[model samples]
Target: MTWLIVALVLVVAAAGLLRWRRPAWYWLTFGVTLAALRVLVRYGSVMDACGLTVPAPRWRLTLARMTNRPVPGPRAPRILRFRVTRTGLVLRLKLRPGQDAFDVAASCDRLRHSFAMYGVTSRELRSGVVELRMTGYDVLKRVQMPALAETRPMRVPVALREDGAVHYRDYRAVPHGLVIGATESGKSVYQRNLVAALAPQRVALVGIDCKQGVELFPLARRFSALADNPDTAAELLDALVSHMQDVYQLIRAEQRITADVPDAEIAADIWDLPENLRPVPIVVLVDEVAELALFATKDDEKRRDRIITALARLAQLGRAAGIYLEICGQRFGSELGKGITMLRAQLTGRTAHRVNDEASANMAFGDIAPDAVLAAISIPTDTPGVAITGDSAGGWARIRAPHTTLRQAVNVCNRHADLTPDLPALAPFRPALGTLAPVPAPAVESAPAAA
Candidate 1:
């Protein structure tokens, strides 16, 4: 009997340690069963306490009274199905007559606390049914991307969502994106992940890094064009604008708009063009938008206006021409100067990492909920890559990009250098490789050697 007690104590101690250090293992070994039991036993009472219950109907009350039966107090949503996932549980519920998905979503925090879950999110699956996803632990604490699966064209899985789902950077869905974070906020790491993801694909990468070629130049092998200064970036932008016009002209020529032609054959965008004839898509990465916007002299002011205007035009029309913009910065606001807000408006996808102030978060999530801004600013210094991702449509989620070191990203780019596309208009800006020789070793003094 004493041995049995000792074994029980040991098991509990190990579980506690696992829960602290290896949450995923702990969840798989013990947490799942215990969580399931908790939900099954206390669901009804917990729902009632959380006010997620509807009063019994009048007819039911009348029938109970007539039959001399106890009165029904309230009705909680019926659980249609309960599913256990690696990260947490999914509960599909049938809403009570008076209840809707909104109520459940509104009370997610209460539900999360009552169920002892890490996080809870809800979405309506159908008219009367809603799906509640509960996370067993903080998935973002240690980012591990899920197993590879078939992905769609122009989509790259860049991060892990808080709910254990993959967060994809889908260019087709969001043609332009704005990424903002303070220094050492893992903004550069996120960009490296993006570049690595797109390296193997048949696409052209255009980099505008105004930091003296520090950030984006390392992965130059896979980039069709790279500009290390604002002047070159302006020229590159003009070249891209011209390339877009050329693509549009090609699409017009291939429209096949005759009355007898099928509507599907009437090409609109590059995707609709014949595979052999279609030009490769281009992803423009602007390392620091503020660099291009800041100006001191009259010449600098003219240059800044030109650059902003070119960027705005690209954001407005580049989508249909297979050109996408990824604008990254520490802060995106009117302080950068005129036309900044207009460009921000055109970027539908917003991602904010740890920012220095609330105003920076607001600049990133201008069209999203205020809560998103709050979440962005609240990110602690220890967590670097954690960010809030949202879009102009609405809603937001926390995501953390898998860490990709500079060397790893460079290796990836080198591995797929053959996939780099040739864009004639921007060929002048193509990064020159093997142009600089290693610095010669300094010679030792003969007198010092003799001594």
Candidate 2:
């Protein structure tokens, strides 16, 4: 007994030291707490008391008792499993017959208070199962994502979700996305992580950096095409639209509705076609979209209108053509001019880092999740990679990407430069990549000269 007591004391000391040194370590100690069982019971009791449980109808109870049948009391959700991670505890609960996951999700705040846990969020796992994520601490402060293995083609892990899962930028799922952040608000860092993750993939990259290519040029080895100025950007966009049209033509030709193919399997996106016949997917990265939207003179205005229209078209129709857009800017607002709102609406995925104002946050998440606006704007200025990300589903989460330097991203791109694909349409806009071997010296016409 004495030795057991000493061991317990030592374990407590070690946990306390770990908590003091590394806050993330504190989360690991939660699983071993003896109070966990007690807390579960207390949670169940509190849930019943708070009327969260679906009680047996009074008629049924009375009828059963009158017939001398077994009268069952109200049924409460049963604890299925609990697992601890570096950020939080995931508690799975088995719902009663009459109760569903929505009942639990609707009363999550009350559940959090009753359990005395940090933050409690719930999501339906399967039909009758619900998973509750209880975050012990803010995981966004120090982000460290697990090593990513590209499970699916073109799916790049961009950030660590609050629940300690990797969040992916899956072009197949969301073809176009909008990123908004203030200067020095970790937008560049996030893009760096994204580019680094994508450099190794078998996809073509195109960049338009109006900031004199300061942001995207260093990683140009992986980009098949790049545009650094307004005039060049306009031309590049036009070329992409032409390429998109050609791809659509190819898809249409290959798409023959026959008895062999099911209606569901009919070619709608690039993935639906055969691998050999499919064209290379292109990811257009637009750094500082505001640069392309704002103009001064009439010619500039015409140029701006052209760029915006091309971008809007790509967002609307590029998914089926295997063209995706990643537009990043310090600010996105209607003030940029007409078509800005239309373009923003087409981007289904929204990610906003620390912004200078609420208006910038709203520009990213206003139409989807108004609640996330405050969270995006409230991100600490010092937290570089922290962000609020949401999809069209109206769900949002606080995520953070690991710090990836520009040099690292550049190195990755250079190492994989040979993997860059050949696209004839983009050949004119293709950057002078370092992967191409020097052209053989022009053949000399020695015999003719001698004659």
Candidate 3:
């Protein structure tokens, strides 16, 4: 009897040691074997001690039976099926006669938590089924594995999200953003992508390209107005401001006269105004913003000052009025002159592409994230479309705008063109078209035809 007791103790100690020192699979094998041996030797005593009992695996049998169910005509199956996947998991569930995917997702939380005890996780594949994925003990190490999946439009490359969806984080929420990049740094491509995406919507497009209309003229077909120089830009902006004022007045008029209108019937913005009073939301794109600041002589300095003051006012008040700015520039620093820094402060969203100088990058991301300036400067010249973006929330992200060409942007603009409106406030600032006329046209024509 004494020898038998000692042998039992030794066996129990060995089993515990194996479990502690070996892998889970090895421990499972050893434990099952030892338990089997104990059951054979001790018979009924061992069974009673462990309270061991075996029940038929009903779940496995039920699954098998469900799989064999015959399909009736073109109708779908009733049971959902799913398989675990490498990156995440895949699920395929057949909906019940009246059930949908949302039903399955509703119960996923409980299922996930229950499976967590076994180092397994489950998520709703859809309304009908769920997927179970094994989580290794060393889960953190597994996460570091090189990503094998290819980047798709639905996938965000950075840790932050920029999937181009018109959700809270995207166009529907922010409405506008300012992008700063030097020449050859791919700012134009980013602008092109943004315009291409937004053009399909009902928003009106406005462009101020001080590059002699070379960069944006092709897109004139879509743009309500395209200003080629500072003088024209000032006029175009003043028109937009007048348009904004009208929108505000409309809002105020609606607020004052309360009707038995439904919640949805209330006019909240330009989009919700009555058809007659509805002004389309304008997305103003400014290219080479520095041109709006540069002055060749002291005589022209006053004109530049007026332009700056107008832009600053727009940047400060336009957002709530539904006239948003998307200002692009090669440089946007204090060196640009007095109002430049003030203008930068009004731009809540910042995207800095590869810059020619650190100072330009600092101008874009300095007050927000100084480290992001370093990252922007380090971006390789070859990677023109890649940029560092920061928002008013102080969150930063890296994004690469898909390549876009000048022609594509022009085509987008041409498609959205509408009859331009005149701004009376800007009448004095409008550049004299006569002064821009060909020198020979005025001189020769005025001399009279030599018939």
Best by the TM-score measure? 1
In candidate 1 the C-alpha lDDT for residue 99 amounts to 86
Pairs with steric clashes in candidate 1: none
Which residue pairs clash within candidate 3? Answer: 80-93, 80-94, 81-92, 101-127, 219-410, 221-414, 222-413, 222-414, 222-417
Higher TM-score: candidate 1 or 2?
Answer: 1
Query: What does candidate 1's lDDT look like per residue over 1-451, in tens digits?
Result: 9999999999999999999999989999999999999888999998999889999999999999999999998989999999998888989999989887888999999988888999999989999999998899999999888788446778998998988788999999999999999999999999999999888788899999999989999999999999999899989999999999999999999998999999988899999998999999999999999999999899999999999999999999999899999999998899999999999999999999999998999898856667798899899999999999998767899999989999999999999998888888988999988766789989976665564
lDDT of 2 by residue, 407-434 (tens): 8889999899898887999999888755
Q: Which scores higher on lDDT, 1 or 3? A: 1
Local error of candidate 2 at residue 355 (angstroms): 1.8
Would you give me the overall lDDT of model 3?
A: 0.60
Candidate 1 stretches with Cα past 4 Å from truth are 62-70, 435-451
Give the TM-score of each candidate: 0.93, 0.87, 0.56
Clashes of each: 0, 0, 9
- The TM-score of candidate 3 is 0.56
The candidate scoring highest on lDDT is: 1
TM-score of 1: 0.93
Output the lDDT of residue 382, model 2: 76
C-alpha lDDT of candidate 1 relative to the true structure: 0.92
